[model samples]
Target chain A: MAYFDYLPHLVLFTIGTLIGLEISYKWHSEPFVKKKIEPVPLILALIGGGLMIFYAPLGLLFIGFVIGMRPGYGIYESVIGILFALILWVTL
Target chain B: MYYPVNFNLIYILLEIITAFIFGGLLLGLHRKVMARIQGRPGPPIVQHLLHTFKFYIKELSIPNTSSMPLYVAIVLAMDAVWILALIVGPILGGSFLIIIMCYAVHKVAEHGIGLASGSPYTKLGSTRAVLSATAEMPLIAVPALVFFKTDTLLLDGIINYQIVNGSLFTQLPLVALAMFVLVLSKTPYSPFGIVWGKDIVSGYKTEHFGVIRGVMMMGEILAFFALLWCFITIFFGGIITAPLAYMVAMTGITVILAFICALTPMVAPYHAVMIQWIFAILAVVNVLLI
Candidate 1:
C-alpha cells in the first residue's frame, strides 16, 4: 500500500524523463538527417528525476546536471521538476 | 486627522524618486556582481546612473529607416506604463489587477517599438519578445494563487492575510518556488535574456539610442524593482517589517540571480516556452492540491 502512495510521483518522474530524452534527442539531431542521438544525458535525467521524486535534496544535484548540459536540457525545466517533487512531498 | 489630497500626491512623488534611485543602484550592483563572478573588476556602483546622465546629454537621432512617430511614442508609452505598474504593485498597495494590466500595456509598447523600428534585428527580437510574453503569461497565476489563498486581489489585503496567518513561503513552498522561478526568469540576466541576447544586438532596442534608449533602460530597471518588490511583499511580508529589510532581501535576490545567470547558458526560445509551460502546470497542480 505504501508503494501505491508513491505511484503518482513515480509516474510523473518517468514521464518527465521520457520527455527530457525526446527533447534532448531532437535538440542534438536537428538540421542533420541522420545524426546519432546521445543517450547519456537522457539516462541521467531519468535516473536523477526519479531519485528526486523520492528524495528532494537529490533534485539540487539534478539541477546542476541539467545546467551543465546546456542547449540539451533546460535549467528551468529541471527547476520545474524539482518544484513538482517538492509539491508532492508536501501534499502526498 | 487625515491630511489633504496634496499630501498623498507628495508621498507618491517621493515614492517614485526613491524607486528610481534604488532601481538604478540595483542595476549597477547587478552588473558589478556579474562581472566579479566572471573574474573581472566591474564598473562603479553608480555606473548605471552615470550612463543615464550621459544619455541625457547625447544628441538624439531618429533612424531614417524607422517610423519616427511610432518609435518615439512607444518608447514614451513603455516608460509611462511601467511607472504606473510600479505604483500599483505591492510597493504601493494598489490593486493587483491594475498591475497586471500595466504589464500587458508594457508588452504592447515593447511590440510597438520593435515593429516601428523597421530593422530586421529588432523584428526578430520582437518575435522572441512575443514568445517570451506568451510563456510568461503563466506568471499571472501568482496573484491568482494569492487571491485564492487570501480571498482578496489587493496587495494590502494579501499582506494583511499573511500577517494574520504565517508566511506563505512556509505554507505554500511550492507556489513560492514557482513564483521565485518566474521572477528569476524575468530578471535581466537569466536564460530568458533571449530577448536581448547577443544574437539580436540588444534586441528590440537595436535601433534606439540616446534619450529614447535611456528612457527604455530606466523603465527596465524600474520594472525590475517593482517585480522584486511584488515578490517580497507576496511571499515574505510577514517576516519583513522595515524598509531596510526589504532592501536587504532585494539585494540578496539580485545577487543570487546574478550567480544563476553567470552559471547558466541561455536556452533557446522554444525551450524557454516549454519550461514556462511545465512550471505553469506544476503551479496549477499545486494550487489545486492546496
Candidate 2:
C-alpha cells in the first residue's frame, strides 16, 4: 500500500518533481508537432497516476503524471504539490 | 445486515458529484444573496449549474494562434487535477498539503491558460494571476501557524489533535482572518478578483469557450468545494462528519463571502495586490510574534 516514509518523500523531491518540471518545460517550449503527442497517452497517464495515488507510493504516481503531462499544465501544479507535502516532512 | 465491500467506488463517485453540485449551488447562492444585498433581484440558486451545462452543449473552437496542445490540455488538466484533489482530500482523508497544493495549482494554471490563448486579454489576465499569487505569499503563515499548534500537516493528524485540544482557530484568529482574504480572492466579482476583472473580458478564459469552458467550469466548482471542505474540516474540526451541520456552516461562510463581494467594489489591480500583501504580512507578523 501507500507509504509515508522519508524515502518516498525524498524520491518525490529528487526524481518525481524534477521529471514533471522537465516534461512540462519541454512540452510547452518545443513545437507541438515535433513530438506528435496523442490524447491517449495523456489520458492513460491520468488514469494510472490517479489509481496509483490510492495504491502505491504517491511519489511514483506524480512522476508518471509529469511524464504524461507533456502539455505542461500540471507542471506547476505537481511541483507545488510536492512542496506542500515536504512542508510537513521538513518539520518532522 | 451488512454493507458492500465495493463502497470505495460509490463513495468516490458520490463525493465528486456532491462536490460539483455543492460548489455550483454555493456560487449561485452567493450570487443571489449578493444581489439582495445590492438591492437587486438575483437568479435562482441553480443558475450557475445551468450555465455550466450550457457551455458544454455549445460549439467548441480553438484559436489559430493558440498553442494547440496546451490549449486543449489545460482544460483537461483543470478538471483532472481537481478530481484528484477530491479523491486525495475528502474521499481518502489525505494530507491537507495535497488539498492546498491543488488550490495553488489552480492559480498557476490560470496563468498558463491565459498565455496559451494568444489573446491580449488572456495574457494580461495571466500576468495579474501571477502577481496576485505572489502577493498572497504571506498566507503561508496560516499553515505554519497551524503546524506550530497541531504539530502536523496531515488533515487526519490535525483533526485528531483538534479532537483533544479544541479548534486551533481559537488561538489563531489572525491566521483565520488572513484566510478569509484568500476566500475573497477566489470568489467572482470580489474586490481581490483582479485576474478576472471586468476590464479583462473574462480574463484568462476569454478565449476558452464551449466544451472547454464547461470543463473549466466544473474544475472551478470542484476547486471551490474542496477548498471550503478543507478549510472547514481543518479549522472547525469534526463538523464534517455531520452532513446537516457541515451544510449549515458552509452556507454561513458562503453568505459572508457573498456579502463582502457585493459591498466592495473591485479595486485597481495593483492596489488589490498591495492590500492582500498588507493583510497577509500583518497576519504573518502576528503568527511570528505569537
Candidate 3:
C-alpha cells in the first residue's frame, strides 16, 4: 500500500506551514527570515518530521530524543511510563 | 469498514451542535473549578460561553501593527483545521492518523497566530509555540502504539477491537497515558500550555481580540470537542453504545483534566520541553518492549 494515500492531509499540512512562513516573512524584523531564533529551519524540520511520521508510523522517533535527552533516555516520560507500564503489565 | 451509510448527516450535525453546547458548559465549569481551587471566587460557570457570544456581537478588533488580512486569515484557518478534525474524528470515523495531521496543521496555525499579531509578546508566543511543539512531538508515538496494539489504524476498527477484546485503555494503558498527556498538553490552560502562558501576556494570542478572539475561541471549542471525542472513541469504545453516555464521558474527562490543570503550576519553558520529550521517549521504549 502506498503511504501517499493520505496525500490531501499532507497538502493541507504543507499549506499551513507555508502560511506560517508568509506570516513570519511579513512581520519578522530582518525582512526574509528571523536571524536569532531561526524559525524557517525549525519549520522545515517540523514539516520534515511530520512527513516522516505520516509516511511511516513505525519510524524510530525515540532515537532522536534518546540521544539529546540524557539521564539514560528521559526522567518524567520514562519514569511515569515505566511505572504505569509495570502496574498495567502486572494487573491486566 | 466505515459503515458510513448507516450514519445520518443531519443527526450527526445535531450531535456536533450538542457537543459544542455541552463542551462550552463543561469548559466554563473547568474555569469555575480552577478558580475555586486557587482560593478566588470565579465567574459564573457560563462565563466562557458568554464571552464566546460577546466576542461575536462585539466589533472585530485587529491590531494596528498587524498586516492586513493575514491576521484575519490565520484566525479562520485555525478554525478550519478543527472543523476538519470535527469531520474526520466525530463525523466520518476516519483513520486515527488523520487527526494527528490536523493537530500538526493546528500547530502551524498557532505559530502563525503569534507571528501575524505584530507584537513583541506575540513574537515570543510564536517562538514558544514552535519550541513547545518540540516537547509535544514525542506524542506522535501514540498512533504508533495504537496501531501496534490493535493491528489496525482506522478509528472504527480500533473501536471495534475494543468492543470485542476490551478497551486499549485496560489492555495497553501506556497508550492511554500518552493520550492523556496529549489531552492535557492541548487543554486551554493546562500546565503544558506554554503557548498561551501568562508571562507572555496571553502568549500568542496577545494581540488577537474582539471577533478575531471569538473566532479563535470557537475553533478552540471545536478543537476541545474533537480531542475528547477522539479520546473517547479511541480508548473508551464501550461508551459509544449510548450517545448520552458518550457525552457524559466527555464531561467526566474534562472535570478530571481540569482538576489536574488547576492544581499544577505552569512548567518552565525549558523544563516543559524536557518533560514532553521524556514522555515521548518513555512511550517508544515501553511500546517496543511490549
Candidate 4:
C-alpha cells in the first residue's frame, strides 16, 4: 500500500519530464538539425532520478541531499545525514 | 470515461480563475511595494487589471523587425501552458511533482519566447531568467526530498502529514525556510528579483506590450498562484481537515510573504548566491537529520 502511493507520482513525473523534453527540443531545434535528433539527456537524468525515488523509497531524500551537496561535503552534512539515516533505519 | 466521482470540472475552472485573480493581486501588491520603496503612492490593485484589460483589446503594432507568427505562437504557448498548469492541478488531484513540472514547463516556455525575440534586452532578460532558473533547480529539489522522507508526494498527503504531525515547520524547519526562499526567488521577488526587476528594463517584457503583454501578464499571475499553491501544499500542508481554513491561512501567509518582498533590501547576485549556499547547507543537514 505504501509503495503503491508513490507509483502514481512516479508515473506523472516521468510523463511530465518527457513532455517538457519534447517541447524543449521542438522549440530549440533549428531547421537544418531537424533531421538529426536524439533523446534529451537532461530529461533522462530527471527521469532516472525520479525512478530511483520511486523504487527504493527510503534514503533517497538523504541521498539526493548528499549528492546535491557534492565534493564540498561538510561535517554538519555528514553528521546530520548519518544520524537521521540511523533514526529512520531503526524506526521505519 | 469515469474512474470515480473525484474529479470536478467546475471546481477546476474556478481554481484557474482564482489563480489569475491571485496573480493580478500580486501585480497590485508589487506596485504598492515599489511605490513605498520609492516614496510615492503607486496605482491601485485594479490598476493592473484596468490597464491590461484596455491593452488586451488595443491594436497590436508589430515592428518591421518582428516575426509575427513566431511571436504570437510563443506568446500563446506561454499563456496556454500556464493556464494548463492550473487546470491540471485539480484534475490530477494536485499531484505534487506534476505541480513542480508545471512550473518548470512554464519557465522553459518563457525562456524560449525570450530567446526567440532576438532583441538585446530580451536576450539579456532571457539569460538572467535562465541563470536564476538554474540557481533554483537544486533549491526546488530540496522540497521533493522532504516529500519523499515523509512518504507522501501528493498535496493531500503532505497536508494530512501536517495535520497528523502538527505543523511541518517543526519537523523540516530547514526545508521550510529553504522553500520560502525558493518561492521568493522562483517568483523573482525583490533582491533576488533579477528577471523582471525595476532596473532591468522589465527583463523579457522590454519589447512586449499590448495584448501580447496582457497575455503574459495573465500567465504571470497564473504561474504565481501555481507556485504559491505548491509552496503552501508542501510546507504548510494542503486542504486538510478544513479546506476553507487552510485556504485562508495560505492566503494570509502569501500576503505576508509578499509584504516581506516589499520591505527586504534587494540583495545582489552574489548575495543571492550566499543565501542559496546557506540554504543548501541547511538542506544537507536536514536530509541527514530526517
| Leading candidate by lDDT | 2
What is each predicted model's overall lDDT from 0 to 1?
A: 0.71, 0.72, 0.70, 0.59
DockQ of each: 0.01, 0.01, 0.01, 0.01
lDDT of 3 by residue, B1-290 (tens): 43346667665655555555556667876886787687764655445666887888887767788878888998899888887787777667789888899888889989999998789999999999999888777787788888888898888788888889887777666667778888888887899899999999999888887888888998888888888888888888854645556666887898898899999999999988888877777777777777
Per candidate, native contacts kept equal 0.00, 0.00, 0.00, 0.00
Q: What lDDT is reached at residue B206 by model 4?
A: 77
lDDT of 1 by residue, A23-47 (tens): 5556666542432334565445445
Query: Which pairs of residues collide in candidate 2?
Result: none
Model 1: per-residue Cα lDDT over B1-290, one tens digit each = 12233436656656665666677767777877888788765655456766876787788888788987888999988888878877676335779888778777877777788889899989988888888888878866777877888899888877788899988888777777777777777677688777777878878878888998888878877788787887888889888756667777988998988888888888999998888778877878888887
Residues forming the 10-long window of minimal summed lDDT in candidate 4 chain B: B238-247
Off by over 4 Å in 1: A1-92, B1-7
Query: What lDDT score is found at residue B40 in candidate 1?
Result: 65
Instruction: Report how far off residue B267 is in candidate 4 (Å).
Output: 3.4
- Residue A57, candidate 2: how far off, in angstroms? 40
lDDT by residue for model 2 over B149-207, one digit each (tens)? Answer: 78898877887888888876676777777877887788888999989888889899899
Candidate 3 lDDT over A12-77, as tens digits, reads 433333343345345543523213434333433343344443442211122112111211112234
Model 2: runs farther than 4 Å from truth?
A: A1-92, B1-7, B238-240
Error of 1 at B166 (Å): 0.9
The TM-score each candidate achieves on chain A is: 0.36, 0.38, 0.30, 0.32
lDDT of 2: 0.72
